[model samples]
Target chain A: MPQLVTVKVNRPDRRPVRVWVPVLPVALVLFPVVVLVVLAAIVACVVFRIGVVRALGAAWRVISALPGARFDIEQGRTAVLVAIR
Target chain B: MTEQRKDILDMLVAGKITAEEAEQLIAALERDQAPATGSLDARPKGKVKYLRVVVDATDNGEPSRVNVRVPLQLLRAGVRLAALVPPQALVKANASLSDSGVPIDLTQLKPEQLEALVEHLDEVTVEVDSPDATVRVFCE
Candidate 1:
């Protein structure tokens, strides 16, 4: 799981902008809500005849893979970058 | 003087090549020997971690670039998630993909097949270069 995410933007005539977000605290605060969502999801899967274990596993995999991703784009004198760590 | 530089100087002294030509040759050689910028290695040193896509283009004299690095784990996770799709949905997706000229069958995708593909991705690199644009896709 990613603990931090950074975003940067630069424009020709404007001051560059940068932001760093710490994810751990947010994740912690959301833990209870996540648990409830998971429970509801499992129940929904059961009612829908979907495999609960597979659904949970797939969700976990997606979340676990969120770290280490980066995207950067630039045009003319403007640029934007996003990084997960 | 390195051996190659000495050779170039000798050639210049002997008039086999003009001073301007020798200068250009030395400059080219120096550039060839210079340390590369950005990542030092062309290929990842160990297990590949990211799938990278880089694009640089100039249109109407305006330059643009895009760089994306996606974790390989995300690809693995996506493959796993694909398996959970209902067969009916996969069939529809396959038909839609084919209609779009992609010619791929989502129904036939398997985790083992993706693993094999990922293993080979470590050794694969794709590049496209033209006057106005350059693109690269590779795993690193």
Candidate 2:
């Protein structure tokens, strides 16, 4: 069996943020934070659907291209595996 | 037909060699067979423009996945943007996998902020090595 090879091309933007420093007091940073927080929430929700939740989407593409081989996304990277004989 | 010629073309297509190298080779061949032209210095030198990204994965006891290559400029922007985000925000995004070392909720970043970060990216460049073919992001 041909070993599996997974290739992941990082999107121009991939990894998420770690910390959340206000740089200013809550009162001062509230407006920007609110906007950012709202956007972040929307983005986070979309990411689950676009990045994580849609597992079968990538697999379907791989399956259509090569029936004998399988492709899927784990985390966010592309995974390619060979079908058993 | 010659192995040397084949190697040159392969390298050119693979972006391993500059346009000048191919041009030099062609010039050398031409000079070898026929009369030389005007000044060779006048010839255009082609530099490799597009960046390369290579990913190699293996499923052994190690079970390693290596992501090689990132456009230096784009990476710098990513790193800078990564720095702006605090660790708490990452944890909040529920995407922090510290051992993996990549930032959390990155894909969830806002489009405007992301675009702003990348706008200045042209001024910076970086090369990173990662186990999972991800853009580099370090948070303290």
Which candidate has the highest lDDT of all?
Answer: 1
Docking class of 2: incorrect
**Per-residue accuracy of model 2 over A25-71 as CA lDDT, tens digit each:** 44365878777865675576465443422333333332233322222
Off by over 4 Å in 1: A31-40, B1-45
| Residue B128 miss distance in model 1 (angstroms) | 0.9
Give the worst 10-residue stretch by lDDT in candidate 1 chain A: A41-50
Q: Given the true complex, what DockQ would model 1 score? A: 0.52
Q: What is the DockQ of candidate 2?
A: 0.04
Clashing pairs for predicted structure model 1, backbone only: none
What's the lDDT for residue A78 in model 1? 91
DockQ of each: 0.52, 0.04
> How would you encode candidate 1's per-residue C-alpha lDDT over A54-81 as one tens digit per residue?
9889888988898999999999999999
iRMSD of all candidate structures: 1.4, 13.4
